[model samples]
Target: VPRDIASRQAKNMCDEGRGVGPAIKERDPNGNERMMRRGVYLDFSEAIGRLGRDAVSARYGNLFEMYQRITGDDPYEVPMRIYPAVHYTMGGLWVDYDLESNVPGLYIAGEANFSDHGANRLGASALMQGLADGYFVLPDTMNDYLADMLRLGKVDPNAPEIAEAKRSVEERVARLMALRGSRSVDDFHMALGRIMWEYCGMERRDAGLRDAIKQIRALKEEFWRDARITGQADELNQALEKAGRLLDFFELAELMCIDALHRRESCGGHFRAESQTPEGEALRHDDEFLYVAAWEWGGENRPPILHKEDLVYKDIELKQRSYK
Candidate 1:
């Protein structure tokens, strides 16, 4: 999810760099390959709902009654269901106001840096945030960092640590491709997505979440054992590409569940079935649980350390959020 957002933000950055054009082009300052614009943003809820309504009307021949019964409102007079999709991630690597991550040399901008949105992101603000960070924030911040690097001289990429990391990644990729197994990588990925969407989706409960954890563990074990690949590690293999992403998704899914589990109270997107008011709205326990639960990666299937970042409310009063 983080990688997807980063890629999108990078594409948007590249687009903004190249003035108004049919195809975005990036000029490589260094010898490194320039990134390009790519990615499709689809709102599934709207698309699926439209398809469902159309199919139901075509099949049953009673659109009005079905719509009224399902929504308890007139279709012509009311707007359809339009909840926020997974969309873009708001929280990411902790950064200062200057868009510099905790790491000095490495700078994070756009969706990769958690600065703009507090809890819930506002509509149309994503583009604004991305543009602002890339065009305005990163330029100045990166310039400062670069200036410092110039003064200190460029760090050697041949350093033992860097070399070791690269070698490790290469070996991991090679191992994945070398695997002689039955099930395709896509099969494992699709299964993982289905499990995640079913369990850690919009609505969540303790029992369901617990069950999901066990199920995901079993799936991951199956993935490691039964996963297959038909291409060499060095080649441009789409299957291998997807497998890497799926691996990341599997790790991220567990984190999402852990974050959701720790956050007992419902707030914004983090809805808990156990935590709701008598009126059926989200019940926030501000006194006891008013902090963002940030998780640090432990290991494969191991629980992460829960670090709380206190949410201080000043402009917006701490009141019950409602939509009726």
Candidate 2:
């Protein structure tokens, strides 16, 4: 409902100028600063007082294990170091009204497509949309698309283009194996993860995003040059599979920064610090950025080309939202 920007607000609170942590130091009626750490103090001791240890364990079994792992402190004794992180990505492959991607015959559904959530995702609604796609939408839409395909007849497996594509994949895997470097694939992955966490995590600014793009490009170069993987590709090779997945993540991370850099307006999860209000709320430039950004791969080592789909609302009228 709040356009999914609470994570940004949390990061903003920990900024250099306003390192307030989780506490809200609001002035009381008597003019004294009243510190309120909302959701900061999940008092296990209090909860245990109301409901015994067995009840607490039953209620928060997962969190209890997490508390032991993270801090090794009893949940009843100390509050967990709660922090916001990059959890669900509200973006993915672009899809049309029929949930079909630009690529012919390819259909995206649920979390695989970016159609449902937009730049923001609300809790219950997000799940509902995915359910709707699965049960109601995709069935009818896929049938419509498949009906046309039926007329075209069963596809030839030995088609030239299909064989070429298969060969391309084989060549890519062989290349990765042959061009083995000193550093392990895990090392590069960890480095890439750190870079993304530091520069492109919950909070993003222009300088950091720019630096991220540069760093990602450099890391991507080093990744291609110095990634190592053990074992043969034909066998059940987990490392090879991981390395391949990581290859996509590297490119995706770079494109993420590029897209972040391109969109100057602060809206929802894609918050640009330069476009936020003084009070730190995201400032949406609807006039300028009311469109979906789609990026296409433009060959190896080339920047992705962005194509926009204009958003035209038929039911809802545009209005500025404010919450105080």
Candidate 3:
């Protein structure tokens, strides 16, 4: 089975209240420790017996060691308790053919840019993407922008626009530092993670997504009101950095939910509950949603604007994927 299918199946079992093994405990965003269901079983005992422990150890010695270290379970004798978690970020900031974003002079490359993968990225593709983008694509394309920049002369650091940008950063940092609340940044982060994973993880529905947006907004408000940062802006503060990043994470989470709400069809890793076949297979609607949803941020008060980039295939034809 594909990674997406495996994840969906695991989540399905958990959702249906048939999850096995001891409940794994983790701290939720609300500062409470919750026991999450583990629905997947990874049995290595049969493999260990068939291939011999030495052969299996030779193949996955490091992984086995790491797993044992974390869980204190011996895979050689017992089946490993497992569940799918987030591995890679398939999509990121939108970029053009030259790897340039809408903002001039900013060139995005590798995992930071959304170009190569569509809805889902296969295993080991991130490495291939990083190597291609870093070694080949950005090197050649960045030169085009650099040459243009050279023609325009040097930019002044003391410019009004530059000063305003600097001021904005300082102000934001000051606001973060000024928080005297009892809750740590991690509290808010954990809460936000819970919201996203619950509503927008393996599968999604209209009601859940709408409810998620509201919950996320409420949490974001709570974060702004109560999040505590320990250090000043001038010093190297990991907590402050986390606080800032968590703010962005909140925004990104909302955007993801909004995007999920808009695209009602199940495609790639995004499995909409309302858009599946009788056999529980993902149904892709190629006619209505065969374009890239390039969302433009519409400020704090307004909703985001969706810009569609139609996908055109000349050499290859688009077809529904089957894992039957």
Please estimate how well model 3 matches the true structure, expressed as its whole-model Cα lDDT: 0.83
Q: Which stretches of candidate 3 lie over 4 Å from their true place?
A: 15-18, 24-34, 44-76
Q: What TM-score does model 1 achieve against the real structure?
A: 0.70
* Candidate 3 structure, TM-score to reference: 0.87
Tens digits of per-residue lDDT, candidate 3, 191-301, equal: 888888888988899999999999898988988788788976788999999998998898899999999999999987788999988767789898899888999999986
Candidate 1 per-residue lDDT over residues 159-227, each given as its tens digit: 998999999999888878877789998877767765665567656789778777777777778777888
C-alpha lDDT of all candidate models, in order: 0.67, 0.76, 0.83
Best by lDDT: 3
lDDT of 2 by residue, 1-324 (tens): 253465555545553334423666653322245565533333467778888888988889888788788778777677654546667666789888999998987988877788866455666767877898899988998998888888998779999989999999999899888757898888777777767766677667889888888877787788779888889989998889888998899889888888888888876677677887776677889999898998989999787888888889999997655686
Ranked candidates, highest lDDT first: 3, 2, 1
Q: Count the backbone clashes (under 3 Å) in each candidate.
A: 0, 0, 2
Give residue 48's error in model 2 in angstroms: 13
Deviation of model 1 at 170, angstroms: 1.9
Residue pairs of candidate 3 with colliding backbone atoms: 29-190, 29-191
